[model samples]
Target: MDLSVTGDPVLAQDETEVHAGIYLQKGTLTLTRKGKDFVAYHALVMFASANATPWAAQRVKFTATGPDSKAVEVTVDLLNDSWDGPRAGIAEAIWKVVALAATAAGDIGITYAPPGRT
Candidate 1:
C-alpha cells in the first residue's frame, strides 16, 4: 500500500481503517497493535452473576491521551446500542473503536478473565 500525503486539508474520519501505509496522525500513532502507544483503553465490563443489562445503555468507554499527555474519555455506541442478553452462552464480545483523531489513536489491547481467574 503506497501512501502519499494527500494535499487535501481535511481531517480523516474516525471510521477510516488504518491499513498499511495509510495516512495517520503524524508523530502520533502506529500502524500495528500490541505494545502500542497507549492512546486509549476500552474498559469492558462483565457482570459475574447477572442476567440482564446493567444500566440500559452500555456504551464502550475509553480514555485516550494525546501528545500533550492529557487524557480524554471517548465513548462509542454499540451495534444496537444495547446488550441485554444472558452471559451463559455468550461466546465472546467484540468492540471496535474508530479513528479517534487523537494525538495518538491506537487500538487498545483487550483480554477477558471470565468470572473467576487470576
Candidate 2:
C-alpha cells in the first residue's frame, strides 16, 4: 500500500475571503494489494478549513480503481463535529478517518484504527 499527498496550487477564492491562506489542496492515498498490485484503490481528500466554518470534517472522497482502468468514487460525509479542544486536532482526526476508510475499502490486509480506539 502506498500513500501520498497531491496539492493544488490554486487557492479557493471564496474561502480565501475568510481564511486568507487556505488552498483547495488535495491529497491522494492509494492502496494496492501485495500480490495483485495492479488493481489499486485510491482515496482522494480535499480538506476545507474550519477557520471559516465550525465543521469537523470538511470534505473527503474515496476512489476505487479496477483492472480495466475504470474508477468509482464515493463522497464521504463525516458527522463528528463536537470538537472543542484545539484547531490543530481537527487535521489529525480528518487524516485518521481518511486512512481508516481507505484501508477498509481496499482490504489492504493491515488493520487500521484511530490512535486511541480500535
Candidate 3:
C-alpha cells in the first residue's frame, strides 16, 4: 500500500485501492491485482510560479471494468519540500472532481419511455 518514488509499488489483490505520484527517477512501477483491471481517469499537476516553490498534485480514478464495474477515485497531494499532513477534504475534493468529470463525459442513458413507450 506504500508507494515510493524509488522502489516499484504494486497494488494488492485483496485491496482495491491506488495511489498517485511522480517517479523521481526512471523506474518501473507495477500495478498488481487479484482479478481486476486498473484504469487511470486523469492526472493533475500543481506547480508553483518562477518566484515560488514547486508543488505537485496527482489524481487517479479507478473503475473496475470486470464483472463488477465499481468506481473509486484516489487523489494524492504532493507538498513541495515541506510535508503537509493529510487532510480529509483533499480526498473529498478528489472524488468531487472525478464525479463531475464522469457526469460531463456523457448522459446517464436512462430514458423513461413509460407504459406507452416511444
Candidate 4:
C-alpha cells in the first residue's frame, strides 16, 4: 500500500474570534491485493461557521483495476471536527478509506495487520 498526503492542512486564523478557521486538504492512497491495485483520492474541507466554532467534511473515492474491480466512494460531514487533534482525525479518515477500498476489491482474501506484525 502506498499513501501520499499531498496537501497538508493549512488552518486560516481568526484574529478577532477564537476558532479553528478553514482549510482544504488532499491526499492519494493506493493498495494492492491479489495482483490488483486500488487507487483512492481523498479531499477534505474545513469550513468556518458563525454558529459553530469549527467543522469539516471529507470525501474519498476508490478506483480499482482488475477483472472484478469495484469502485467505492463516500463523503462524511462533521467528521472529527472536535479538538481531539489532527492525528486522530486523519487516522480515522484513512482507515475508513482503506476499509472501503478493501470492500471494493472483492473476495481477494486481503487482510491487514499493524506495522511490524506478521
Candidate 5:
C-alpha cells in the first residue's frame, strides 16, 4: 500500500487511531490502532482451531514506529501438537499487522489536510 504522509502538505503531528475487523471462515481476526504518525499496534486472538483440530487461542502484538517503520511483534498460544503447524499462525500475525497499518494509513490519507489547504 502507498502509505505516504508527505503528500499532504498540511499534516499534523498528533497521533491517530485506526481499527479493522477481519472475519475469516475459521477465525476471528481483528486489527487495531493502525496508521497515525508515531506508532501502530495490533493484537489478534484465535479462539478456536480449524476443522476441529483443537488449536489454542493465538495472541499477537506489534508496534510500528513512525509513518514508515514496519516494526512488528507476534505472540502465539498453541497446543504442543499445533505449535509447529506449518507456520500458519505466524503468517497470520504478520498479515494482520500489515493490514492494520494499511487501514490506519488509509485513514490518515482520507483525513489529511494541508495546513493551509482547507
Candidate 6:
C-alpha cells in the first residue's frame, strides 16, 4: 500500500497487527484549527482495515450507547480507508451501565450483579 503525509511526518509505523491485516499507527495527525475555544470533554478515534469480506468489518464494529440511550457506533471503513482498524481493544459502555474491560465474552455487556457482587 502507498501511504503518504503532506506537511507533518509520520513518527513510527508498528508492524504489529491487532487482527489479521490491521496495524497500529504511531504518528500524529496534522491539526489545522482556528482561534476558538471549542470546549470538549473526551474524544475517540477508530480505524478498521481488512481484506476479507463478510466477517472483516464485523470485528471492527464496536457499538455502544450514549447519554440518552442514544446509539453510538465507532468503526473504521475497511473498504474505504484500506488501513488499520481502531485500537486493538475497542472498549465501549452504555450510559448508566458499567462496561468493564474485556475479561470474557460473558463479561462484555451491562452487569446486574452490582458492585463487588461477583
Q: Give the alpha carbon lDDT tens digit for every residue of 2-109 in model 4.
A: 987777775443322221111113224554555655554443322222343332122233333333555544333333456332323334545444344434432333
- Best TM-score among the predictions, by candidate number: 2
Which rank order by TM-score, best down to worst?
2, 1, 4, 3, 5, 6
lDDT of 3 by residue, 6-118 (tens): 77865333322223322212112112256544344343322222222222222343322232444444334533235442233344434344334333421322121111123
Residue 58 displacement (Å), model 4 = 5.8
TM-score of each: 0.27, 0.30, 0.25, 0.26, 0.22, 0.19
After TM-score superposition, what is the CA distance of residue 79 in candidate 1 from its true location, in Å?
4.1
Candidate 2: TM-score?
Answer: 0.30
Which candidate wins on lDDT?
2
Clashes of 5: 2
Whole-model lDDT per candidate: 0.32, 0.41, 0.32, 0.36, 0.38, 0.26
Candidate 3 Cα deviation (angstroms), residue 114: 55
lDDT of prediction 6: 0.26
Instruction: Give the runs in model 6 whose Cα sits over 4 Å from its true position.
Output: 1-59, 77-118
Which of 1 and 2 is ahead in lDDT? 2
Decreasing lDDT order of the candidates: 2, 5, 4, 3, 1, 6
lDDT string for model 6 (2-88, tens) is 997578754322311222222112121111124322221222322122342211222333243333445444443322244333233
Model 2 residue 42 distance off true place after TM-score fit, in angstroms: 2.0
Candidate 1's C-alpha runs over 4 A off are 1-38, 42-57, 79-118
Q: Pairs clashing in candidate 5?
A: 10-114, 10-115
Better of 2 and 5 by TM-score: 2
List, residue by residue over 30-74, the lDDT tens digit for candidate 2. Answer: 434444323224444433334444222334655556456676554
